[model samples]
Target chain A: MPYVNVKVAGNLTEDQKRKIVEGITELLQDVAGKPPESTYVVIDEVNRENWGKGGKLLSDKEK
Target chain B: MPYVNVKVAGNLTEDQKRKIVEGITELLQDVAGKPPESTYVVIDEVNRENWGKGGKLLSDKEK
Candidate 1:
């Protein structure tokens, strides 16, 4: 079984989160050969200030 | 620098979760050369019935 984790910006709507989790679970179950029961998915959201990319904070860089 | 994902069972104490996240972050940073801001972690919990391994549910297999 495979465990799946997702990291995204903190502003996702509940619907988005739900769809993403379910999608990932299915993907892992089929692609990774993980059992449905053995698959776990976690989502972590971070503030723009806390996330950085390309040498700048995501919030700052995006603006 | 890196997006770190941890796949773990449910029912971890907050302390265990924190330690695991921090440890994974450090490992990714050191091993993958990812910046601190680029690291993210998520935890997911599932019922044993939903998780299977070795042709059996983890909860059932363990029991």
Candidate 2:
């Protein structure tokens, strides 16, 4: 089974989530030969406060 | 940079989160020779309804 985890720095709408799940699964099937039925796609929506880049939290970027 | 993702099937308290983050960061530093400051440890507390195994949703298991 191919377990794929996708992390993003905010919330996603239900429609967005569905598309992402489909896209990632299709990409894996096309590139890695993984079967969609056995693939596990776990999406993580991290809070901006919990993620950081360049020594600054994503939560602070909006300021 | 070594990016680590830790997924669990429920919510975690702040204390639990602190411990887990520290543990994973230290593990990578010790085993992979990665620096703790540079390693990224992302924790995903996945809801049961969003996860499945053996053709069954984890949310159904408790019922």
Candidate 3:
């Protein structure tokens, strides 16, 4: 089983989540011959305050 | 940089999130010699309907 984890700095609509899940599943299946039904896509809606990049939190970077 | 994703069936409190991040960072550093500063820990709270096990949705399993 292929486990895919996607992290986003903010929220996503249900439609967006659906599209992302579908897209990732298709990509893995096409590129690596993974089974779509067996692939697991876990999306994380991370708070900007908790996400760090370039030694700074995303929230700080936005300021 | 090492990226770690943790998937949970339910939500977590802010304190719990903090501990998980800290614990994972420490584990990676001590076990794999990864740098805590550059390591990324992301936690995803997945809905029962979206998570599947044994070809059945987790929501259905609970019913």
**Candidates' C-alpha lDDT:** 0.60, 0.76, 0.78
* Ranking of all predicted structures according to lDDT, beginning with the best and ending with the worst: 3, 2, 1
For every candidate, the chain B TM-score is 0.78, 0.88, 0.86
Question: Could you tell me the lDDT of residue B60 within candidate 2?
Answer: 56
In model 3 chain A, the worst 10-residue window by lDDT is A13-22
Off by over 4 Å in 2: B1-45, B48-63
Let me know the TM-score candidate 2 reaches against the reference structure: 0.55
Interface RMSD of each: 9.8, 4.6, 4.4
- What would the TM-score be for candidate 1 when compared with the true structure? 0.50
Instruction: Give the DockQ-based CAPRI class for model 1.
Output: incorrect
For residues B1-63, write the lDDT of model 2, one tens digit per residue.
Answer: 888878887799999989988998898889889998898878878976555443334555577
* Model 3 steric clash total: 0
Candidate 3 docking class: incorrect
lDDT of 2 by residue, A1-63 (tens): 788667889997655666666777777778988777787767677899999999999889889
Error of 2 at A50 (Å): 0.9
lDDT of 1 by residue, B1-63 (tens): 335464644455677667656655654445334466666666665676787666888788777
What's the i-RMS for candidate 2 in angstroms?
4.6
What is residue B31's positional error in candidate 1, in angstroms?
A: 30
Each prediction's RMSD to truth: 10.0, 6.6, 7.1
What are the per-residue Cα lDDT tens digits for candidate 3 across B1-63?
999878887689999999999999999899999999999888878886555443344555587
